[model samples]
Target: MREHRGFEALGQAVALAEPPLIESSARTDVGVHRRVNEDAVFADGGVYVVADGMGGHEAGDLASAAAIEPFRALAAAHGARDYRMVEATIELARRAVDTVSLRTERGAGCTLTGVVLIEHGGIPHWYVMNVGDSRVYLHSGAELTQLTVDHSLHAELLAEGRAEAADTPRNVITRALGSGDSRHDAWLLPVHAGGASWCALTG
Candidate 1:
């Protein structure tokens, strides 16, 4: 809850709130060894997405892009849809990814990570999602915390203490869009006004 600051002696100090202005940006790079970049980044109208294609998949690029297509469409036209809208959008994206796999017939798939802006009771909120190894982070004050867990063998091994994740070559994802597990981990979070987001790429 926001604290009411200052004295409200002047007729209760009535003030109107302005609608949040949505903003976003994105960037991606073809990794060192891949001939084709299998990662997709999308940011628009307060919707942000990053997807990585499954390694060795022939149509990974298409899968990654397809995973974000539904949200891309929603960015241009949306209202205060709440979580219902978010669930529908993700289903759309999953279907798009499935189409890509069927058209290619290559078992194509990709990891999905994203944050969508929505309104709840006239207040802005964020709908966050993740699948496979892609992740989302929340930065508050001096702490940056991971908000999603990886749906990968490496993560599972680490979680179960079966094996150390020091070398990930032995690891493979257990979930992805259009392949393996198709479930999306989702969260509804309050959007702190005046907060910002950015893209940070490592290798």
Candidate 2:
């Protein structure tokens, strides 16, 4: 809600920095298909996030914004150096998203993924978060590595070693904000001196 609204066939670029050390860039494109771009992105010092709202329902836009609201506050406060803070913030975010769904008769939901810069043992680190199928990637020079596991039906099937079910589609998310599931996954990593890229997609 604090940034630009997604527009059809539009692409947005953002430059984020951690001061004298890190420089990052992010973009979001609505492409040519959807009439309403229900995705939203937030990029600033030490925080980057993407929320892919469940399409077809107008409330998905609200759900995605609701999901990132708390994180936006966290980022404004420089995110969390303590892992416990992240947990508390996530709870707040879940409640906020739930409120959005409760207000809509058809319900609403979204996938969220992002990274926060934190300090651990006097060293800076990246605190990564993921819910639903939205992904977060770490880029170094020419190499890219996925850092978050998606909370989706296909991922669940693969985790259960059901090779036969691996063919399941990616859209069936197992967990998401406003889906009545308050759980998510996260990772804490040391910030690379060479500067790495973190991208979370929604549109």
Candidate 3:
């Protein structure tokens, strides 16, 4: 299996009297059965992103790479703080993936999930965005809480009591980039100094 790893830490300490240090780590592996890894990640400049390409589709890797390129570029420019910029970046990613879909003619698509550190009233906060089934989790003390909902058929089925979570196919995502649906969910929450968060792109 092909494995890729990345790590990032924000050195620009939060301007608080006692600044909070931020650190992160990410790893992705291509399954034993897969020939290539179809996941891409960007973790830098107080921004983190994970894009999981649709399996069983042509050019999955390319789709995922395209989906993350915009965010990666933005990270180089100090990342985004306004919600509008974040939304615009995602839209650009959607178009990038769509270009792959059109060129490959194999329904290329990917799930995008990410978080950006922002400031509100001089206090730090996390702005989360999600599309498809990729997830974000916040760990506080000994408890782990999911911060994003899955946009997948299995999740919908379980929510409606039409199917059991164990019986549903987890890979059936209901929304994704390049699917002509650019809509995504967003949330803003205070970032506690001692708390930690991470993003996961599950198949």
lDDT of 3 by residue, 13-70 (tens): 3445554587888888897978899999988877789998888678889999999899
Segments of candidate 1 deviating more than 4 angstroms: 1-16, 164-171, 196-203
lDDT of every predicted structure (CA atoms)? 0.72, 0.71, 0.76
**Which portions of model 3 miss their true places by more than 4 Å?**
1-19, 78-80, 163-166
**Deviation (Å) of 70 in candidate 1:** 1.1
TM-score, cand. 2 vs. native: 0.82
The best candidate by lDDT is 3
User: Candidate 2 overall Cα lDDT vs. reference?
Assistant: 0.71
lDDT of 2 by residue, 110-187 (tens): 888888776655556676877788898877788988878878778888888998566788788877888756477777
* Model 2: pairs clashing at backbone N, Cα or C within 3 Å: none
Residue 59 in candidate 2 has what lDDT? 83
Better of 2 and 3 by TM-score: 3
